[model samples]
Target: MKIAITADIHLKQSKDEAPERYNALINIIKKIKDEKIDKLIIAGDLFDKEAKNYNIFDEFVKINNDITFYVIPGNHDVGLNQKYFTANNLQIFNSAQVLSFNNNAIKIFLIPYSADNSMGEVLAQNEQQLPEKWVLLGHGDYITGQSTPNPYEPGIYMLLTRHDIETYNPVKVILGHIHKREIFGKVHYVGSPCGLDITETGKRYFTIVDTNSGEVTSNKILTDILYYNENLIMLPVEDEFGYIEQQIQKMIKGWSLSDDELTKVRLRLKINGYTSDLKKLQSIVNDALKNFTFYNDKEPDLTEVNVLKDNERIQIIELVKEAIEKNDKELGLLQLTQNDVMEQSLHIILNKA
Candidate 1:
C-alpha cells in the first residue's frame, strides 16, 4: 500500500518562498522518509496565486508529522479553504475525497478544485460504488479539445472527460494541472516537481500508487534546477576555427555534462553561421561556453555571426573555387594552390569597414 504522488508546486507568497520551490518539496519529504512511506499526495497547484505563505506551508507540514499531506485545489489554488491552512499535518481537500488505506485494504478517489463543477460534477456527489480496483485522483482538463494546456491557468478549470474515465471505472487516473509529464491511456500527469520554467525540462517526478497491485510508478525527484537550450551553427568553411572547435565539442558532448555536472546547468547557447573569425569567434565561444550560466542572462549570441565582407568575400571565394574545381576533376587531384588557398582564407577576415 504505497502512495506518494505530487503536482504543480507553484508555492509562492513572497517571503523568499522559493528555495528552489521549497527545495523540491524538501527532496520529496526526504524520499518520503527514506521510503518508509506514510502517504503524501498533492494533486494541485499547492499555492502560487496570491500565495499567503501559510506559514511557509506550515514549515513544511512541521517537517514530518509522520507524513500525511493530502491537498487538492488547482487552477492555481481556486476557492481554496482548509481553514486557510494551519496544517495539523495538512489535509486541505475541500470536497470529493473518499480515501481509505491498508485497513479497508485501500480504496481511493479524490476530486478537489472546482471553479464550478466539471470533474463529473464533483464525482456526482459520491454515489459510492466504484471500488473494484478503483483509483482516480484529480485536478483538471483531461483531453477532448484541450490537450494539456494550463501552464498557469488560461482557460477551463476542472474538466476531466473520457466520459469521466469511462464512467468512473478508474484503474489509475491520477492527475494534476499539466506542468509537463503526461499520459492518457490510464490517465496520469504527475509533472512539475521542479524546473517550473524554461519549459520544464528533464527529470523530475513523484508518483507511486500501488494500493495492493493497482500499480503505478515513478519516483525520481533530484531537482535543484536544470534547464538547457543549445544551438551552434557556424560553417563559412576554411575550417572556421576548426568549425568553432568542432561545434563546441558537439555541444559539450550533447550535454552528457560531467566536470562536476557543471553547476546544475542552466545553459541557453546559440551561435549562428558565418564566422571567419569574429575575435576568433568570440574566443572559441568564450572558451568552450565557459561552463554555462547564461539562460539568456547574457552572451553567446554573436548577432548571427557575419564576418566575410568585401563583396561577400569575393562571392564566397569564387564559390569555394567552384567547389574545389568540381572536387579536383572528380578526384584525379592536381597541382592546385586552390585559388591561393581561397585567397589566404579571405585574408584573415577582420574588416568591419
Candidate 2:
C-alpha cells in the first residue's frame, strides 16, 4: 500500500486567514487521491495554534472520502480532549497504541504527545514485540542535548533520544516537532509542509512511503506565500557607491522569483572603505532594489568604514586598499567593519565636521 506522510500542517481560521496554507494542504490531498494512495498519515501539528475550527473537518469531508487519515495530536492541537475523531475518515490517536492495517501486514506504533514525562511510562507500559514492518509515529522533541521548540524560538521541550528508539527498535520512526526535514538513522523528522515563517528558508516537501518495499520518497510542494532572501556581501573598502550596487545585484542575480511573489531581499553590505553620506548610500541601494516587492524592508547594515582615525585616515585607507589587492592575504577587512572600530569611525565621520 502507498501511504503519504506529512507533518506540521498548522491549519487555522482567522479574520485575515492564510489561504496559501489551506490551498497547499488541499492540493496535497488532491495529489494523494489522484495517485490513488490508500492512506494518509500526519505525524503531528495539524493545527497552527489550537484546534478551534470545526470548518476544517467539513473541508476534509469535501475532499477524498475513501482515503483513511490517521492524525496524532501535536502540541498545538493537544489543548482539548480529542481522544476520538468522528469527522470524515479521520482517526485520532491521543495516546500510545498499536494500529494494525492491511491484514496485520502494516503495524503503526502510535505514541501521542504528552507535555509531562509520561511518554516514557507509556512506552514502558506498552512494551511488546512489534511487527516486522512496523513504523513508529509520534510528536515530541527528539534531541540528544536540548530541544529547540521552534526553528527561531529558544525553548527546551520534553526530549527523546535515539537510544530511546533503539530500545523499542521499529523499522522506521517518523517524528513531528522540528520544522526542518532531517533523518538520523531510521528516525525521520518530516518538517513543515510549508515555510511557516521567513526564518524557514528553502523548499518544503512531504514524504511518500511505499509500504510494500519500504522505500521513502520526498515530494516537493510550493507553499510559500512570500519569498525572503537575506544576503551578507563583503567588499574591500571601495569609495564608489555604484560598485556596491553592482556587487549586490551580482550576488542576487540567481533569484528566480515570479513577478507576483512577494520578495524581500535584506542586503547587509559590510565594506571597509570611506564613503560620503551613509544615508545616501542606503537610499541608492534601497531605490535600486525597489523593483522587488518585499512586505517589510529593514534598515540595511551599511558599514562604510575607516580603519584609521583622525589624521591617519588617508594612510589607513591606502593600507587597507593594498591589503585587499593582495587577495591572497587574509587581512580580515570584513571582520573589522563589524566591530566597534567601524562604529567609532561612523561616529567620527558622520557626527563630526
Highest-lDDT candidate: 1
Give lDDT: candidate 1, residue 205: 81
Tens digit per residue, CA lDDT, model 1, 161-278: 8987787677888888887777778888988888766667666788888888878887877777777666665656665677568767876776665565557667777776565568
Cα deviation in Å at residue 340, candidate 2? 16
Residue-by-residue lDDT tens digits, candidate 2, 1-353: 77888888777764247566676677677788788886888887877775576565554643667878788877777753443334557777767788776764667787777777544555677776456667777887777553334753355444567777777777777888788787777777788887676665555678887666666777866564544555443223444466567756764564554443324332333444445455666677677776654434544455544333344554454454444446533436555433234334444543542
Estimate candidate 1's alpha-carbon lDDT, on a 0 to 1 scale.
0.74
The 0-to-1 C-alpha lDDT of every candidate, in the order given, reads 0.74, 0.63
Residue ranges of candidate 2 with Cα displaced over 4 Å: 79-86, 103-106, 118-120, 146-154, 226-231, 234-236, 239-280, 297-353
TM-score top scorer:
2
Error of 2 at 54 (Å): 1.9
TM-scores of the models, in the order given: 0.33, 0.73
Error of 2 at 349 (Å): 17
Residue 236 accuracy (lDDT) in model 2: 30
